[model samples]
Target: MMYKSTLSVKKEIALHLLFWVIWVYFTLAVVDANGIHFAEMDLFSSTWCITYVVTFYVNYLFVLPKVFHPFKWIKAIAGLVVIFLFFAALRYFLEQFLTVQLFNVQNYNPGTGILYYIYDNTFYAARPIILSSAFWLIVLLVRLLDYNKYIIEEQKNTEIKFLKAQINPHFVFNTLNNIYSMVHFQSPNALPAIEKLSSIMRFTTYEAPRNFIRLGEELNYIHAYLELEELRHYDKSFVSWETTVQSDNHEIPPYLLSPLVENALKHGSYTAEIPIIIRLSCNDQQLDFEVINRIGNQKKDKLGGIGIDNLKNRLEILYPEKHTLQTTEQEGLFSAHLVIYFQ
Candidate 1:
């Protein structure tokens, strides 16, 4: 924290110094005179530029921040007026008293009235303060954008964590129930189910925390899960899994594709004619996945659950406009089709 704050302060100081150096250089560039007269005028201009610098920094560093608050337009205007008066006073003292006393020279005639002198100086003195306000506004806008970006990223990470937390327990509870059923019956599949559960638990506990994993790794998890489901149903022929991947180098968010499969398994009617069909295809630029199953009348009402809802949230956050998910029921068939475009 201290290091970041110190770095920020250093950057601000550097920016201020650069601004002043550029301002002074440009002020000297437009002098339009030659030799001895130019030397006198150059000194005069440099002295006046110092006063302008003071005026600019005073307003920028102290006055503008205080006055540009909520319902403070009156204060802001008043602050500008005070800065203008302060600038006129500084110029008046320099041109009238100090220059006269030191070098017996003054830029203005001794007979010029104070009010007229001040009125004349307003146009010249206003430049620095106006630029200071502009500079301050630009800096404020940049900081606001940075802070907004920080806040959005933080919220996205928090939401992803929350969804993952919700998904893990929901998954573990369902799998544990499946294992309990096999154990209660004292079936030979109990040990295999326990092993499958161990593989799944390792994936969820260790690998799920990553933002993304290789496509093949996630596919392996899905394969293990499907095997576990087959053990649960005591029928290895109830699911048909197909994949056509040109390469396995692609990456995807962990556990993104499993909820659709889970929903289909929980609600699908298993028959020889219409077994649960899951198809996955991946290319260099896109991933296409579909889950099609015969809908059971008894489980149709429970079609959408926490898993699907959680998947929706994760998809919105992780993929945004780069993906599409469609779920529909047609002719006693429920299907979910998901496609994600890679860039």
Candidate 2:
């Protein structure tokens, strides 16, 4: 696989849980002013846990978003005001409940201490908001990653469609036009060339849709295409194609290399007097190929790649940071150079 999935959600959750555990410990220590040790108490008491859940649900699901996002400012602030009064009444009753549970009395008040109100309402309530923010941040990251994956897939599909569209007609038109020209010239080898064309089309139409193909199969397709080119231009000056592929067991994206040769035949050897030379050299880890052609009056556009920008885009999107493509123009002749990662 060219793409690897990134960090998962559970890992992020575990990390957040660790941070929250530490913060809760430190927060309680600060609230107690070192008078109580967390190691000696059950922090998950019903009163504490209920309050935690309530604050977390309200802030995470409603309050913070209403405060932070737009158009809900007035409504959210008003809701917070109502919530503040409700909490004031609720805290008054909850203290009575705790008094009954732990002290056998339903009437008591911890009054005239500003710290108690600030600690209970403000800092403690902020816990769920903080935790949900972390979770939502992870959600945002995952969504962005998924969006990027979608974009890459779209670009790849478009590139493949363009390459398939460009090369199919280009190769066929050249072959058919060659046969058409040969039929008038009374060449004896025209029928066999057409048969080779059939084989080439068979592979393309049947197999090229696959994502990966054996290097040997791709090279065979190249050989079939080159044979058709040779048959079509038998009378043209000597043009030689030599492919010395080192490794055959690996797989690569199909039809990626065929366009280079097709371009060479279409443009490089358009004229009869000058020969176009193409060679494929490969190692266990890399494939290097080059095509050189003589410029002619009616030459196909040397801007390159089978009449579509798809080839360049494919090489870049699929093999970027792994492959290299360079085009150099010198002495009225043009060449396309490619190095594809093989291993």
Candidate 3:
């Protein structure tokens, strides 16, 4: 794509001019002012000659790629210098045959002798050698750009994999903590909590590893976990969740909503009076997932905890240029808003 884009009308005109300039300059350096070719026309008028364009077209279109590719550094700068030097030598031999035989113009007859052959050929060498050397430099720069793109792509993949791995260990740790709380309290509801834990565990272990899932299925799993949290802290605390969307079962990335809801519960103390709100809404091209909790002044330090930091990293890696995450901490409210562009 870069090759095609760079080679355009302007560049073609420049190459045409450059070719004639090179031809005239090199030829004039060796030939006298009263030479037969010089007598035919001066530089300005000679540029208009029909043979000039044809010579340039054949040289640039055919000879350019042949010499250029041979001179290119497929390896490194040292390789480029070495290859360009070799291709320059090869170019001299090619010029000897091509200028005499390829063009075959009627008026441009030359004496057939070996030393003059080598001299004329060697004289013609500079233009192609310089152009091919320039081409080699371009190839080296392109190679470096391609290498950078490869590294960035690999790094992106690694980060996505890390975000996918993040959720399950968090789920395990939360469930184990719940079980510990149950064992300590000697609560009769522990068995039922264990059952809810099993359902969530089964889904997270199986379904959440996938790239995407049905919104309905994810909502059902979230509902199950929320019910378990309710059962666990019912006598001592309060929590609530609400969800609305344009579609019933649209597909989205798995575990997209889990981290936000989990962070709300993870940070807020069990003794807060008001219910925590985890409201989620989605339209055709946008999703707004917000978590609102009331924290006393002393407990406000929980705002930038491990879970929220992980949440930010996951969003950055996943969306990069699309999603927006903002956290606001005012007098009594700690809230986070996540706006995702689903389109």
How well is each residue in 21-67 modelled by candidate 3, as lDDT tens digits? 77667654446567634435543333233333433344445544554
Per-model TM-score, in order, reads 0.87, 0.71, 0.62
lDDT of 1 by residue, 242-335 (tens): 9899997798988888998889878888765679999999998899999999989786824478888999989999999999999888998989
Clashes of each: 0, 0, 0
Model 1 misplaced stretches (Cα beyond 4 Å): 1-18, 30-43, 69-71, 104-114, 301-303
> Candidate 2 residues 277-323, lDDT tens each?
77788787798878777655575537555543667776776787888
Could you tell which candidate, 2 or 3, scores higher by lDDT? 2
Candidate 1, lDDT over the whole model: 0.84
Off by over 4 Å in 3: 1-123, 126-147, 235-237, 270-273, 296-298
Kindly indicate the candidate among 1 and 3 with the higher TM-score.
1
In angstroms, the error of model 1 at 144 is 1.7
